[model samples]
Target: MKQTGAIVSVADVAWIIALWVNRSIHSSMKTLKWLLNLDFEQQMNETEKIKRAKQIAIIAGVFTAFVGVLLLLNYLQIKKSDPLNSLVLEKLVERLSSEPNNQQFVEEIRQVDLLMRKAYFTSLWQVRTGAYLMLLGAIVLVLSLRVYYGLRFAIDQPSADQIKEKKKRQLTQRWIGISGALVIILAIMSAFFTMNHLRSYEPEKMIVHSKAGDESIEQLEIVSIRTSETEIDTVIITESTDVEVKQPEVAITQQPEMVVFNEETVKINHNAFRGSWGNAVSSSTNLPTSWDGATGKNILWKTELPIHGYNSPVIWNEKLFLSSANTSKRVVYCYDRNSGKLLWEREVNNIQGSPATQPKTTEDTGLAAPTLTVDGEKVFAIFGNGDIIAFDLNGNRVWAINLGVPDNHYGHSSSLLTWEKKLFIQYDTHSGSKVMALSTETGKTIWETVRTNDVSWASPILAKVDGKFQLIMLANPNLSGYDINTGKQLWSVDCMSGEVGPSPVYGGGLVYATNEYARMVAVNPKTGEKVWEDNYYLPEVSSPAYHNRYIYIATTFAVVACFEAATGKFLWEFDAKNSFYSSPMIAEGKVWVFDTGGKAYIFESGSEPKLISSPELGEKVFATPVFADGRVYIRGVKHLYCIGVN
Candidate 1:
């Protein structure tokens, strides 16, 4: 059947070509029949034949001249305005580098460039083609004028035979005129087909390129040192060091022996801002009950940061990681948690393009809005440009990959999370929203679930319900839950609206969802049912925190409110000193909320509005503070401060 179809297609194409050729031959024969006739002198007198030939030539020459002039003018217009420029070519190169593994993109780029070059050459040659046609028409007109004059100057007059030939000559002129019009029409049809063929070379879609202009990177170099060696093991320190020549290695023993390496297991504290659910707060431990950054009452150390971002810091072991970026560069900063000293800085080049190739952003949303994730082994960070990079504890880059440019309107703010060695990235965009699970050891995707949401800023939180772990997130008009291991939608409910910023908080057999201009709904994860919803005092930016039977919320306008977890009942509202962008945190029977004006408000967690103490940290704060051990790490616009009693 396939072979039959192939044969049939070839036969059809051959028939089309043959038909066009036959038409062209017939038209040509009719156009030049009078000139090729050998018996013209016997059939018609010279005077009569000349008169008829001049009329035919004059009409054909005028028609051909008009076509030639039209083609010449079109060619000149094309030369004046060409679309291919350096900027356009540069964008194509950038798009090529973005997805080097995509073969389709590579082929499309090649075809686009080839077509553009072909168009330039075709327009240039059209000028010469038109000029040649004009010259031919001019020669024909001159010959017609010569024939008219020679016939009129003859002295001998014609007889009755000449009078009869004059009528025949006039009839032949009508046939030639009909043939000339058809010839001109055929030329136009051929040109039309040629242009149609050229149009087939257009790309499937326009590919725009972006640049990370004037960006400078600071690549951190790390060195390893073997400090001591025992009989069976060695201790090594992975730290940043300068370039220095090393001595030759010396063997400790010459005899071959069996060695048993001891495997040690260490327990890590929940210190980082693990997803949107917040770090596990200790109920009985002694964290700082009160602190003041302006008076230096409990401020341990403050280190200034060069870059600016709203991304919160993540802590693993003894290091605190935070990501920041400008329009040109994205940077990850690692600092010593105890001393607030800068340990190492790693930078990645950024390309800023939004839903379209135009850089879409607002003053509030920046490049590094997503918080970093540290899963004990590697620290992962993602930028608005769809770059996901991972690094080990020693500041060495593990792997990097671009998840295709996101189509978010106000930058991507979906924070990353990890469960059982799989990195979960909530990549919700305006056009192609997906939940991807990647292998932590290698930056390879394990499974991906496409979503129908449009442009959400909420991050996903890991929740355990009905003896299985589920990833819960707030999307446009819905609060959905998915299986953590497999990208399967376990449950979802329509309970959210507007641009979602506050991630869902899971507790007490219910998950609470909130947004800027939407109702706050508490959803049951098992059945995907909305328990209760309220529209009063909805948070625009800050996420809700659940403690005991109450939920705490900090509005964007600096009003701190608490509500009943099970029922949609408003508890109380307090006016915070400044506006809040950071989410509220509950730890040790107190609710901690940071405002935009560098102030931290501490209050008792209850239905009544009671303000305990408001401490002012001199710098502007946009990130949520991390509380672990005895220190609270707050990431300000210009610094990362460790507030603890020394």
Candidate 2:
């Protein structure tokens, strides 16, 4: 009996130890599962569970506080490095506010403004990202604390009815999760619709030009505003006097490449377009009439220029010369004709009239608005400050002369033209305007004819009229002709009025002159009398080009109008869909019209205006293209392009 009692006691002790071991294993399994999904199950003692819950709450609080500190640091960093402090933005705004009429300045301001705003918004998004991360961490930490406390010290004992109630509560929680997900989905859809609705532009607001006095200029303002959920795009045009505001074309479409013919070799003509009245008929039979810049077809080479200018390039033999200037410096550039490589550049630093001393010029009438003239022996260039500098064939400065600061309100823009061995310059300022002929070799004043002229930007043309070479020029009140050899006034007429920008084109024994706010008149160059006058469409800046009896004018309003040279009859016209600043050139039985937005439109100059092809260079073009030596040279705001095939 005694042995049995001892064995029973041992078995009882073994059972107690086994029960303790099983309890520990079950507790560890429950703790591991709870850590994996944060869903602890199984009954626990009150004091121990409370202690565990307190530890979890402390850890969660610490974690949430740490995340909050990180979020705060991110916000402070973003504020410290704000985009408003950028130097580029300051410079752009300064220039934009000063030159209110400069389109290039406005464009640069818009681009920089966009980039800065993007950076600002990107910083904001980064802060938001940190905020989101912090919120998630806080939510997780808060839930962990709440659950830890709620489950701790709860009663483990329950009846059958209590169990049923618990199951119902679990079912409700499942439904709540499902509803929360649906709400999140609905919120996302709403935000997407809101974004799309906000990303749209209203119609443009156009302001009509005020009808002021004849000498009074009117300021017109046009604004385009587009709103999006994330940003706003606003374009403002503040100052415009005679400009007619039209919306730019909506799209730039890509076209197929046009084949450039090169089967036959083309002969180089040095004197082609040497004068303003560039060969009325092109001798380039194999030149490309149509090209696509986007496809890189027939574009032999393009070289980036260093300065800004409205001066067209001049070609002589195998060299190309161009002039450019800014507020402080002037540069004359030379390039190789075949390779489009810049051979040399010379800078003339002895600028007489400081840019500030000169009167305010229109955006188009920049420091270098006049086209360079070359006579194989020498190249000549003129600036808005009445500075004329001559260079040799190898880009060496030959002579420099300052005619004195011009008093014109719109700056000096008369281009240089050469006749025989004399360089012709029409210095028509507000006062003391004169037409001077300088010797090409020594840059000496060969002949000077002072005239009673107003502030005019007209460049003189050397043409053979009535069996004599006459230099024709136009001003506000009169159109005059001078002898090319002696600077003698051959004839003068009080026929033209308004700011004369269009240089008179002499063809068919008549000189065609037109302006924005004046009548289109056909005058006899010999007698300087109005032969015929028409009140039809006219150009603002672009000069009229003539081919026999057909006269072509591409206006700033983007219309290419044709007229009969003899009778002043209006012919057909075509819309280029963009404004034109560069004058039209007649070449190869086609009329080339280059727009300010860098598009070239070629069409037939005849009774009917037929469409050929429109090529875009993706750059701003303000100078007329030079066609010589079987190649076409174009000057953009930043680059010079030579288009031809070898």
lDDT of all predictions? 0.67, 0.65
| Structure candidate 1, residue pairs in collision | none
Estimate, for each residue in 1-646, the C-alpha lDDT of model 1 and write its tens digit: 2332343344345434434433443343353355436775666777676666566565546646465445534433443444232245456656656655444554455556565565545544454454455445545554555556456545357678976886787688668657754654555544444344435333332222334531111122122212122111111111111111112123233444342211111113442343333433433245675667778888899888888888888876678899888776688988988978888888854312222232456768888888888776778888888888777666767666667677888988888887677788888888878787877666666666777777788888877788887888888977888777656677778777788888888878899988878889998998888899999988888888888899888998879999999897998998877888888877678888789998988888888888888888888888887866677878888878888776
Candidate 2's displacement at residue 485, Å, is 1.9
Each prediction's TM-score against the native? 0.60, 0.57
Roughly what TM-score does model 2 have, to 2 decimal places? 0.57
Q: Pick by TM-score: which candidate is best?
A: 1
Consecutive 10-residue window with the lowest summed lDDT within model 1: 234-243
RMSD of 1: 18.4
Tell me the spans in candidate 2 whose CA falls farther than 4 Å from its real position.
Answer: 1-282, 351-359
- Per residue, candidate 2 scores C-alpha lDDT tens digits across 250-355 of 2324453332212121123333232344333344555665555667677888888878888778766678888888777778888888898888777765533334
Error of 1 at 496 (Å): 1.5
The candidate 2 region of ten consecutive residues with least summed lDDT is 259-268
Give all candidate RMSDs, comma-separated: 18.4, 27.1
